[model samples]
Target: MIIAVVDGMGGGIGSQIVSSLRDELPSYVEIYALGTNSIATSAMMKSHANKGATGENAICVSSKKANVIIGPMSIVIPNSMMGEVTCRMSEAISDSEALKILLPLIPEDFELVGLENKPLILLIKDAVKLMKKEFNIK
Candidate 1:
């Protein structure tokens, strides 16, 4: 299956997600790194994503092709990531046919109620676990 890991800014979260997925999933499962900037894409590529693309159009096009999309919750928030995620990018991702698994990392201006502030690593692990369950991966 093709899994897309989307991220922005420094891409620290996406890199971690990609690295964890590389460790947990079969090698044949393609990982597409979709970054909002070149630096973000480069970071994810270093984490060993099978393919990498940057910018809005890349994200929009790749989202549709992905079987699953995993990223921070801000991915669906227009003008999030300090404006790195545009409205069209968020819309494309939100509208994509792929199953989305978003980590609850929101921007400072936004707040989500009733969720524990877990460490990023734990969140990534939980996301990966859910992905395994959803795709029936061992």
Candidate 2:
């Protein structure tokens, strides 16, 4: 299965997700790091992603081929990621025929209710667990 990890900015979150997935998941499950920029893609690649790409078009096209997509809640919101995420990118990711597993991260001007303010590590761990369950990894 291909898991597309979309992230922007410094890509700290995407790197963490890639690291955790590489450590916990079988090698057969490929991780595609789709970044809004080169810096973001490099960060995720350093974390051992199977493959990676950058820019809006890359994200939009790659997302469509993924079996699953993991990233911050901001990914689905148009013009998010400090405006690095464009409308096409958001729409492509949200419209992809993939199971999306978004972290309840706090975005600008919006608070994700019904979610505890957990540590970043804990949130990432939970996301990994959800992905594992979805694929029956165990």
TM-score of each prediction: 0.98, 0.97
Candidate 1: which pairs clash? Answer: none
* Residue 56 shift from truth in candidate 1, angstroms: 0.4
Clashing pairs in 2: none
Candidate 1 residue 66 Cα shift, in angstroms, is 0.5
What is the C-alpha lDDT profile of model 2 across 1-138, one tens digit per residue? 999999999999999999999999999899999999999999999999999999999998998899999999999998887899899999999999999999987467997667789898999999999989988997
How many residue pairs clash in all the candidates, one count each? Answer: 0, 0
Count of backbone collisions within predicted model 1 = 0
Q: How accurate is candidate 2 locally (lDDT)?
A: 0.93
Per-model root-mean-square deviation over C-alphas: 0.5, 0.8
- Candidate 1's displacement at residue 21, Å, is 0.2
Positional deviation of residue 82's Cα in model 2 after best superposition, in angstroms: 1.2
Tens-digit lDDT track of model 1 for 1-138: 999999999999999999999999999999999999999999999999999999999999999999999999999999999999999999999999999999999999999999998999999999999999999999
- Compare the candidates by TM-score and give the number of the best one: 1
